[model samples]
Target chain A: DAGITQSPRYKITETGRQVTLMCHQTWSHSYMFWYRQDLGHGLRLIYYSAAADITDKGEVPDGYVVSRSKTENFPLTLESATRSQTSVYFCASSEQGRETQYFGPGTRLLVL
Target chain B: DQQVKQNSPSLSVQEGRISILNCDYTNSMFDYFLWYKKYPAEGPTFLISISSIKDKNEDGRFTVFLNKSAKHLSLHIVPSQPGDSAVYFCAADRYNSGGYQKVTFGTGTKLQVIP
Candidate 1:
């Protein structure tokens, strides 16, 4: 509604399948980020976008792809989901040059 | 290779007591630090933050202390309440060659406040 949101709060997919997680922000923040939360790794960044057309890779980007066609939307896609990719994904947004981020409810994905 | 590390996986403190969460970083170039709180099935919300230029930053019931030399930071909550029980994450940020700042998060610490 007002803040940020992620679609398919929960999803289950088969291995080698393709899946996409959607993130939308109403604040129009310049920076949007995608992160995966795992057991030992609290939250590892997958990708981040500086603007509508500018995206960059983060620590863990090997299996993830992100695109920002519009300022309010940043979607993350898994070309071929694997079992190791199963985790809770969070989307965050912030103003340019600011480290403080606002996150979405997150999508819990399971790859079987 | 983890720049930010939160060694304590969990902590418990009695109501009305002070809850301290510590975090350490190995990167000497980190210029900013932040703390976030996340509840069950909820996203992390920004709690408090401090810059390398400042040693401490305080809010209502929360205060963040930073030690640049030791490469450590802490979040303290006074008069801990049950509502404060949640997973707290420590994050660090440093500007890279790119124009944007790259932020890294710690493993997080689950703080439980007993009522």
Candidate 2:
């Protein structure tokens, strides 16, 4: 109950449908990140927020959007999901950019 | 291109033997290295980390060694146990030219401790 958490541990959606993955952390870390893990690609950062309302893109950010209105919440949204977007998403948090990150349980999404 | 790489996709070792996992990075800017372990249906958890200034860092049965000159790092698990069977990831951290601190992870190596 004290660490980070992700909602909808498993999700199935149709292509072109909008879906959102929620991430919450009780640590109130300044840095929160969203990463997608796919076969052969490992974990690629989609977006990261340094603090409330300040976010940046990582290696892959297209088709995905993220926002951080509260320090404890960072939610990722897919305006129109595609089959290619099917993968496991992980949310991580750190006190600062240089600190060690703690990850959440992850959300598995299947876009058909 | 993959900046961080784990050449071995999987490793198997005897329960009582030592297990070694290797990782290589193409970026010299990476100053902090970390190792994470993950079990099925779970997020990866931090196991050990070492700063660029140190060649090695140890925590209980897990030890991480960094060879800055070679741009390589390794994780050694002594007296490996079945519980250690999981996916191990090697990650690197650095402040990029864009002024944002970034962390990159390797493809991951699945370690199996056979009894």
Name the top TM-score candidate: 1
lDDT of 2 by residue, B1-115 (tens): 9999999999999999999999999999999999999999999999999999999999999999999999999999998999999999999999976666789999999999999
For candidate 1, what is the DockQ-based docking class? high
User: For model 2, which pairs clash?
Assistant: none
lDDT by residue for model 1 (B1-115), tens: 8889999999999999999999999999898999999999999999999999999999999999999999999999998999999999999999888868789999999999999
Calculate model 2's interface RMSD in Å.
Answer: 0.9
- Candidate 1 error regions (>4 Å): none
State the TM-score of the second chain for every model: 0.98, 0.97
- Sliding window of 10 residues with minimal summed lDDT for model 1 chain B: B93-102
- Looking at model 1, residue B84 earns an lDDT score of 100
The candidate that wins on lDDT is 1
Q: How accurate is candidate 2 locally (lDDT)?
A: 0.94
Model 1 steric clash pairs: none
Return the lDDT, model 2, position A90.
99
